[model samples]
Target chain A: MIDTIAKLNGIIQILALVLILIRAFLVVRDLTKSVTGVFFMFAIFTHLSADMYYLIHIAMNKGYYPPFSAMDLAALGTYLLFGAAAHSLFPERTGERSETIVSVCAALFAAANVFLWGYYSGAWFQDIFSGITFIYLLVTSSQAVYRTGALKRDKWYILGSIWLTFVAGQVCVPILQNAGAVLAANAVEWLNYSLMFGTFLWLAAKVILCARRTEKDQALALSFGLMCWSLCTLYMCAEPFYQLALFGETFQLLLMWFIIERRVKTA
Target chain B: MIYSENIFICIVIPLLLSLLFIRREGFRFVLGLVIGMLVCLLSAYISAFTGTVSEMGHEQVAVYISPVVEEIMKILPVLFVLFIFDPPSDRVFLFAVAVGVGFATFENCCYLLSVGSQSITYMLIRGLAVGVMHIVSILFATIGLMQMREFKAMSLPAAFGAVIVSITYHALYNLLVSEPGITSVIGYLLPGVTAVLLFLVNLRLRIRVKT
Candidate 1:
């Protein structure tokens, strides 16, 4: 049974990779006019790099740890693009000053990424860059929520993707290093794989939802996506922190979405 | 001098007083207090479970654990308010602010106790930063809930996204200021920026309501 589970886990990982590739291809194909689509193309590239890194690491001996990894740069670039895309896609719901501030912040992030890659020395620079990026994400996401009075449906997939990626990158990697219990470690690895697969599906769903929607529908879809994603986090991770981070927000997103949908539908 | 006793006086005492002073809607207020405290405890527990102990420093705690824990805890009272009271957006926002005030006052008290007889400048700064950050985060999370109500599918992601953003903001502030430098100055400025954002958002909501 254990062997079978492990085998199933391996199969799931492979399937997830394939799905990610397909989604990437689809995203690229759709990148005709929309800057957001182009941003997603960058995201896909980052996904591919991250997925390939895992595949290679598993296939070969573990070697090299630092800011120099190609995958690391890809991840960093993905975040920068994602931030920029989010700002561009969602115009300021308030005023010109707010818009200017957000644009400048995004611009600064872009400039920082360039400088970090080009001029900055020391591994700590990478850490600082990442830290700043995290903050940037936080501020922009809050602004998006505050302005729109609803979470974007696409953001659900993004949050899931980020949460899963972080779990794989930070938590699973560290635990795998320790190797105290093989069964538990394998279970976590499988969970990570499942999350990745789910994220891809969620992303695809988001695109479809986005394409089909009126403004009201878009809001509704985003809310539903958030609720489902949150519930998934609760069920899949079975960790309190995950619940706090994912589930709590999920409920809030659901509420906002419902309100907007009601208003729109009535109108 | 007040800093040393702030936790008890600010957090515990007010909480206790609310239990006694609140008259007309006694049960509701009590329920809110209970829910708020539970959320805090749960957040602390979740943080520990994730191995994100603050004492272990940033590497072990901030990155992997704190975001998930703190964000979730911040949302609990909002959930409770929705469940128990079924408040409209205005009432929901007020309840959120109340919960934030409770959480912030307590947190400030704890900080004051730890730091001891600090200068008035330090107290004011800490009060504004930490106190308001707590309120802003809760408000943002609540805004997410309000948004979710309007645009259903956006609910979970918006709420989670808000929490994640707030946690990241809090963590970055902590990380940057742990050392004294240009980064620290930026860190100090963050809460001020965050406070201004909160005020603007609140104003927007008020205008929206009036219109």
Candidate 2:
């Protein structure tokens, strides 16, 4: 079962990567059209880097940097880079000050990782580090949704739904697990995957809609990518939850296609 | 210090020969290659020089320092070209590739010198791995170059973006192969395989764009 889930996740990750690389290839000649392209590039590549780091960890019994594997740290890097990308996409909308604040916060997080690399020895610290990063992402992404005016628009309803569903699942699963309702907890977990899948689909719809409405749709695509990643990180921490990761990565690929298709059409 | 003499001889001969070979059809690529190799050598010397000054050991240099040094070295001339020629961005990518190819060729020659021609199979695989890596690093930077285009001019953020992507990719490759056996197997094939896959994707995307 673990192998099957991992294989599915692998295929999804590859799809995500291939889609972005295709977009990269398309724009390899002219990434100037979208400032967000670099963020997408960093996000995808770091993701692949993290994935490879995990593969090495398990295969070679290395990278167990006490409490957290190097892959965990790499995952943190991806999250921050995505956060920056999301904020950078809507400078006019998100405000320069907020972006600068996020940058400083992210820099602190990166410093914490470097410190952990040398001195970390406890899981709780790692978890708290990740949790703090997750919360920061949630806040920034919320601001992104508002800054992009997605909160007010009917078109952004799906994003709100996706975020709400993910948050509710996160809140409920632990409660159910604590109640010793193993069966109920399992069910909510599955629901998390299903709802996220739907939410990403919704996000995909919004990306295309925004592409039509905005001149800098790639920024929107990147912002969408950040939200998907944030949701995935929130839910996909354990192996059984690996299935949810497929959803976030799949959403990224879908958006990648939307950006490329939009670009080709406009060109 | 061990490599300076041979690397210099290697650079100077090619540099002089390329100067004479200017009328050749592939001279521009060779020029890119030799210049790239020279930069690669210069980068190595700089890193060596830096190593002497910094407290980090040689292992740290290989895994951490070399990528930053080599990537900056590899992209310097390309950046110059980008600024001076201001060719279409696509041409910039192509130019970067030319430099990558050149750098890889010289670096391979140096490797052969240090490690011996060895078994052709080993040399061939190493060549393929290093060549692909060199190309991909520049491509990674070029991809970074594309991202900053929104500003409508080359800027620090743009250059920094390019370096970050390039450095991370370079560092990732170094880390992956930092292990041996199974990790090495994937590491060896990864660059070459991915480079081909990227080419195919680009080709297919181009066709789709046309139709």
Report the poorest 10 consecutive residues by lDDT, candidate 2 chain B: B149-158
State each model's TM-score restricted to chain B: 0.74, 0.85
Candidate 2 C-alpha lDDT tens digits along A67-176: 33334555665565555555555555435575454445434443443333333234556766665555445444545655655534453455444545665675678689
The parts of candidate 1 lying over 4 Å away from their true place are A1-267, B1-14, B24-38, B45-49, B52-55, B58-64, B152-155
* Per-chain TM-score, chain A, candidate 1: 0.45
Please report the candidate that would top DockQ against the real structure: 2
lDDT of 1 by residue, A1-267 (tens): 543443344345445534543543333323313443333333433434344444443333334333423344444444454444344345446874644454454344334433333332345566565545544543454345435544444653456356536344335533665876667777765666466446535543553454345454344334433432343343234233343433243233334323332433354
lDDT of 2 by residue, B1-211 (tens): 2565576675669566766858543665667766777887787788778777766567556655677678878888888887787767666776788889877877777777777885998887788788889899888777656545544534553355455566656666766677677667777887887788667755764665577
For each candidate, give its TM-score against the true structure: 0.43, 0.61
Chain A TM-score values, per prediction = 0.45, 0.66
Over the stretch B1-211, how does candidate 1's per-residue lDDT look in tens digits? Answer: 3333333444455557667666545545454554555455466556666563334544445433554466567777687767677777777776676666666655555556667745998788677776776677676556545654543423332344444444444544554454556655665677778678557645654555577
